[model samples]
Target: MNYYSFLLKNAFEDFKRNKTRTILASLGITIGVFSVVMLIALGIGLKNYIRQQFENMGSNLVMIMPGNDLSEGGFSSFGSSLATGIRFDERDLNTISRVDNIDYVVPIFMKSMVVTSLEKEELASLMGTNEDLFKLMDLKAVEGRILEGQDISSRSKDVVLGISIAEKLFDDAGNAIGKTVRLGNQRFKVIGVVEKMGDPEMDGGIFMSYKTTFGSINPDKNFFTIYVGVDSEGAIEGVKSDIEEALLKRYEEDEFSVSEQSELLDVVNQIFGMINSVLVAIGSISLIVGGIGIMNIMYANVTERTKEIGIRRAIGATKKDILVQFVAESVLLSGLGGIMGLVASALIVLVVRPFFPVALNFLAVFAAIGISSFIGVFFGVFPARRAANLTPIEAIRYE
Candidate 1:
């Protein structure tokens, strides 16, 4: 047989002869690759899901939030509220509404509280907004009707139940409407139930008039966020600048931030990008440990084959031949492990993707396998050289 083919055959024979060592060595790499693949898939899936949610809100959507600096706007600040005591008030909302090229101006208030129905009680978010919120969000009720101008103007105690709360409270959509639910100490009559939005935050929630929220639940707190819909996508930049200029003129310092949907999406991408990198780095730690395992196993293999090495070297075999053979075995072992990991990861993704928003990441898969091969080569070097350097006389005489 050809020398190269004979060396390849020896690699396979080594694995078959020492199944326990081969399996144990390969197991580490399998685990490492699986972790990396799964983590990256999860991160990508969540990022895509979040992006889709924002896109569903509409391309022309703009958000305003209270910030210490004009550029430091954020979505939530449970702790910062106590520290800064800075929040958007009705005056700020009115000022934003006065900006030209704006379609709807709505203030948003979100609070987590216990909601009790006739037969059950559960935790839910109480979202307070004006009647225009429904139009801006493009939300519709599955039954009954949404709030109107009168509801906001009169500060009516009417409430809208999200699908999740409706099901948990009243058992069905039809039975939810016109039901009275207790939010904290106050009672709110459910006038409508919104369709299943699929967003966890908005789905299992209660929608109430902003005036009622401010007047009753949080009399001391002001609005913290505002939603503004520009009349056209083209005019978004112009309107954003105009709002910033107006707010800057009103406040001595940059007390608030104005951001468009596209800009927010960019920020989301950057955050997820960092998170993915960190996750990959964490997962790669396992790969390094696995490489160490491969190295240890390779060293042991060289020890066991000392006699075999002497027999070959005493005949016509060269040091380079022994070196190549050992290296090939190491590469084969790790390559097989990487392939198994890919299969395992693919199976896991199949099982999870149905329940989650995960997608197959081809680049991550390739990188994991490539890294495994490199690990095999890197860790196999010392062992391969040790086997090659054993003199025929010494190796043959060794007990």
Candidate 2:
């Protein structure tokens, strides 16, 4: 028979001779592999979940909110501002659009008032913007169409209802499209209804032309929020920096703040990395416990097979053969456990995927297998060597 076949036969026989002990050793390895796999899968799932949440906000979109500038002795914070003079207007939006690496720039004005229908009345936030707002913010109307340039130029008294507001004012999604809603005692026809935005605050607001809303509500402030989109993924940081510099130069003060999509994603990834590290550290303790169990079982097996070792030594079996047999037994036990653990982990991920999106890392599986096999070899060495070195007479005399 070939060496491979001979080794397999001997390992199987040895396993059969000590079924309970072999099973106990394999259980330890199974637990270790299972812990490591589960921990890794959970970590990846959490990271993906956070990423999806951030993506739901918008892609390659950044908002520059107003802030006050607070400068100490001489050092300036990278993007810090504590002055209250960072009011944005249509002119700022136009200036930002002319900067290099900018895809689109949108200016927003907001106000809160009571919106009333004939049947019911509700409080809602009113947002005003130009036609480019749709493209810059990646917003789409689910029921009807968005506002046009003519609507802004003519200061039309038309309104777009958000999904939640539509539901509250009108009976159904379709009915809300053409119904008239009163905003702050002013009657405006609902020309469109936005799709369900995920955010409760945004879903409770109404969208209108910037000229109309500003003219009707607060026209003198000229204070608004700006949304800027970079030309490409690679240009996000550079574009943000250029916009900040331009604003500082124009305003003659560092009173503006800038945000980038990549910066937000980096913060999210860092938080997830810390969480994953803590989880892996806890899982590693289980692996150490499992390794210790493997060593204990191996020592017990050596004591039980004392007479067997003596009988084999009295025959033609060499010390090398004895050592090889014990080591092979250790590896077979751990290797089988690792395979079973991988299958079980996959099954678990499949079952939980419907409730939570779980991402499996194939690299983590291979690493677990390698570690388990290495543990078998490292822990099995001392016991196997002790058994191989036992003299025939001494082992035979052993009870």
Candidate 3:
């Protein structure tokens, strides 16, 4: 057999002979790789899920929210805006409606409140918009009809519900229609239950007319957001500029933001990017600990094989040969752990994908194996050098 092949055979024999030590040595890397891969998969899945929901809203959709919502970091800006009492009023909405190349305009007032039915009560997101919201969102009712033009015009106390709120309150989605539910301090009759959209605000919210909210729940008549539909995808940039130009006349530049659906998706990606970086940093700690474990196990192996090392050195084996054999064993052990971690991670993703959006990435697979091999070389060198330095007389004399 070739000298290199013989060295590898010895390494494999070592693993087979000390099964417990091999498993213990590899466990650290296995856990580290599994953690890193799973975290990355979860991040990728969340980004994909959010992107899908945005795509469903169509390319022509534009949004105007209070303050620099996207600029201040996604979701975190909401509390600041509310604290400062900055919001869009009817004047801004009217100005946006007159902008050229725009389609429907829907002003929205959103708040979280308790919604109660005869059977149960739950905390729900409440949205006050007009009939135009349905047109802009392309939302359909599964039970009855959504808010109508008459409902908005006459300030009718009719409400549309998300499917989750419907089931939670009425015991079933189909039973929600024609029922009365208390919204804030007033009772509004449920006119429709909309099909389940993936967004939390849409899936578990209460929808009512902005006019209905006025003089009751929302006395100030301030809106949290405004939704706009452009006549064409090409006209989106123009509409965004026009809306900003209009709102800038009534409020400061920092007081509000105008963005499109795609921009919102970008913000979501940016947030996830930061989150994944943190996860990687945390997972690297596990890999380092695992590498240390490998190093310690390799040192113990060298100690146990001192007599065998002396026998080989006294015969024909060179120091380089002794070094290569130990290093090969270390690398093999780490490689096995990396492969085991990948298999375990893949199995977990497969199981979770049916209920959630988790997916295994090929990049993660290559990176994990590459990192494991590098760890093997880095941690194995000291022990390999120690084993090679043993003089035949001294190693043979040791007990």
Candidate 4:
């Protein structure tokens, strides 16, 4: 047989001769690759989902949130729940409105209030916002008219209900309009029921005019967040810079953050990036363990085949031939293990895709295979070198 045929024949025989050890080693690789594949897929899928939601909200919207650190271009306004930052007020809203590129600026004040609809009562988010916010968010009332400028100017006690909130509060979602709902001891006539948004934050909201709710609750209280709409897509960056510059005049540093869709997407991507890194590190631990397993089994193979090595050397087999044969055996086993791991990862993705969004990561698959190939060679080197260095007489004498 040719040298390549001889090497292939010996490698296949070695794998068959040690079935249990080979399977165990391959299993380690399978588990490691599976972890890497699933975790990365999860991160990518979540990032895409969040980005899509934000894009749906509006491409030209810039969000202003209260925070001192503007290093990352923006801080997630959702972080305000920790009560760690200052709040913006009406003066800030007026100041932002005057910025050249800004088309609309709506202040948002959030509070947890007890809302009662006849006999039903639930604790829900009470949003103090103006009619401009409805247009900014692209929200349409399904049953009745949304809050109008007249409601804000008149300081009318009128409320808008999200579809989910309306269903929960009234007998039927359509029936919610024209009904009276109590917000913290004040009765407000429900004038609108917003269309189903499929967002937990907006879907569960109970909205009223900002001036009305804020004036009644506490006129001095500041807003939690502000949404700004720019006139043109090209003007977002200018608006962001103008906002930062305006805020810097009042506070020693930038006490507020200005962010557009791209900046927010960047923040989400960064967060998911860190999460993916942590997950990848965790998965890589298994790969390291698998590599160690490969090493141990290869060493054992050398010990078991000492007499065979001695016979090969005695029959004019070069040191290089002995080394190549051992290395080939280890590489073949590892390659098979990697292929099995890829199949297992693909199966896992299919099974979980319905429950969790997991994109097929072709790059991760290729990387995993490459890493596996490297692991095989790396762990096989020491044992192969040992087999090559063995003297014929010494190997033959070994029991």
Model number with the top lDDT: 3
lDDT of 4: 0.82
Candidate 3 on 38-104: residue-level lDDT in tens? 8889988988888878876766999888777474546688568756847777887789989999888
Which ranges in model 3 have alpha carbons more than 4 Å from their true place? 1-5, 69-79, 82-85
> Lowest-scoring 10 consecutive residues by lDDT in candidate 2?
69-78
Full-model lDDT, candidate 1: 0.85
Estimate the TM-score of every prediction. 0.92, 0.66, 0.93, 0.81
C-alpha lDDT score of every prediction, in listed order:
0.85, 0.77, 0.87, 0.82
Off by over 4 Å in 4: 1-9, 72-82, 112-124, 141-145, 154-198, 215-220, 241-251, 312-317, 351-357
Q: Which stretches of candidate 1 lie over 4 Å from their true place?
A: 1-5, 68-85
What TM-score would candidate 3 get against the native? 0.93
lDDT of 4 by residue, 179-296 (tens): 9988866899999898977666677798888888765675676887899999999999899889889888785554566777677677778788888899989988888788778888
Candidate structures ordered by lDDT, highest first: 3, 1, 4, 2
Please tell me which model should have the higher TM-score, number 1 or number 2. 1
The RMSD of every model to the true structure, in order and in angstroms, is 2.5, 6.5, 2.2, 3.8
Ranking by TM-score: 3, 1, 4, 2
Choose 1 or 4, whichever is better by TM-score: 1
lDDT score of residue 24 within candidate 4:
92
**Residue 111's C-alpha lDDT in candidate 3?**
84
